[model samples]
Target: MTPPPGPPPLPELHWLEQLIERGHPHLQAREMRRIHVPGGPSFPVHAITLGNPDPALPAVGYFGGVHGLERIGAEVVIAFLQNIVTRLAWDTGLHRLLEQVRLVFMPIVNPGGMWAATRANPRGVDLMRNAPIDARERVPYLLGGQRLSAGLPWYRGRLGDPLEAESQALCELVQAELLGRPFSIALDCHSGFGISDRLWFPFAHTREPMPHLAEVQVLKTLFDQSHSHHPYIIEPQSAQYLAHGDLWDHLYLQACENTGRTFLPLTLEMGSWLWVKKNPRQLFSRKGIFNPQIGHRQQRVLRRHLALLDFLARAASSHERWRPPSDDRAQHHAQALAQWFPT
Candidate 1:
């Protein structure tokens, strides 16, 4: 029997466009375009802003698909936009919350990878590992027992620099809009591994937490409160479990350090055992079919993710404070999610 086809391109694009059009009037929207690898596709990064662009109102930026095969991340982002549109149409509280803070959504960062269904760019550079950081001492483990080198799958690329066109484009966008700004939090989504859902912070080179560790802990707490089913595991910057050259490291440590702003970058790793196809090569083959069990689970997880994002956006917009920082212990233990969803 012939296998079922994977998600089509037109339906995804059409759904995104419709969501934006319907929600544009309720939120501030901008079209940011970037050229993919030279002589490649021209990708559009949509920036949606809700509420006034006030410095006091903390902003939340959501991006996904830094790697191509991680299409579930992109789907979650689109789902997020659709959920917001639906809420705006029926929920008054949601419309008011959206109008209080800005939420910038870049659904797909690596369009080239999206097309190829590969992690690296067409030129063979891993954008995640291409950040301008020293990855020589920190190597990522591949599927096999062998460790990845600089030119391999998880390669840091061309002397720890951003050589890929998509990487360069993302860096430029960060500098122009996100960096040197007063955004309190940012989330980048990805899917792989059936490990527990995790909230990863910065500093890939060392295990030390970011200077704003207390604040990050607070935010993690808030996230935990938002969901009862999917528990969130918050860890230090450099855990022994994963190593080196992550985009969050570049953003939170490098960019925020240079700009002197406290931008807490969180890497949300969605469990992939739910939606990922077993035989990835089959996805490209005509006889390949999507695993229904995984897809359904992914859809459910996507809804939970959207709800968490909405809660975070609302908390940031209102500048809600969690438990009173009476002492260092109370302050450190207080998660930001609690502030977002006060009980």
Candidate 2:
């Protein structure tokens, strides 16, 4: 068997490198190269570390494109890196933030799916719903008045287990690098359904909050406060609507159960409708790259969203209290919710 093909170099990738070079002097960016399969693509997962590489500095993991069709998530992660790079060149505050924390980012985890524009990998498995959890069951979906099941878009795979090569690669990376480390937070980006902007936590199998529920609330409050002026962003548990074996649940929840480390995972669901109008191709192409118009609109949103992330990075790095319950919390959360679930 041979290694998987490397991700086709994109114009945006160079832009990201330049941004980091210009904006963040304290941070170091390195690529973690891995073989997707025995004879598959050799994809690179980009890691940007701030402060010391030592375990002392709490780490934050940011990932996008666990679902191949959700290319917008990957683009957003790139945009965030670019903005942070651009901002830090002139901003002392951001520079200080970079000096305090480390951020590990895997912009595109499913290169095979990304290349083909399908939600699942080459084997047809939904990576997001493919964690090693018990609530992993397949259900049928009626889309456009047609029945779709695990064999389709959100297929759980054979016996509701993760069988995709991409899934295995991600699992290996987490165990080798993330587990038992001082990772403070993790954010997985995704899109579809144009639902409200939300922050989803783990334990989708049960409504009961995990032991770190208070920490989850605190992080949610911080996000709400940071985007208070923007008026779009809310906190929604992943299992609120349905239960499944999601990536976050597998990482923070499952990992916590095994290692006893307090790691909080948040799913940042940005509103896709804002970009859908500009990029109609996404609506049609199950595995097609986003149209330029939709891509541009997404870029704008990504820029603003990146600014908020920068603010969060700063706040978290400083170990500042994000509490006191500001009036803007509800409004911003509502605004974000309205964008996806508009009344």
Alpha carbon deviation, residue 6, candidate 1 (Å):
14
Runs of candidate 2 exceeding 4 Å displacement: 1-42, 87-92, 136-151, 159-163, 172-183, 238-240, 258-260, 277-282, 285-292, 320-343
Q: Each candidate's TM vs. the true structure?
A: 0.77, 0.73
Q: Taking the tens digit of each residue's C-alpha lDDT, what string does model 1 give over 1-343?
A: 9735886442445566678788868766666645455565445555565555665556777777787767767778889878777777689876676566767777777766676667766666677767665543534465211224634677556554435666666666565555655555677787774646666677565644456666666666666676656566666535534455566677666555654455777777765544334434444543122211345565777776776667668756754465224476455744532432235
Model 2, 99-193: lDDT tens digits are 66666667777766766667776666677767666453332242211113556666666664434566665665565445655446677777764
Error of 2 at 325 (Å): 16
Model 1 alpha-carbon miss at residue 58, Å: 0.4
Candidate 2 is scored at a TM of 0.73
Give the C-alpha lDDT of model 1. Answer: 0.62
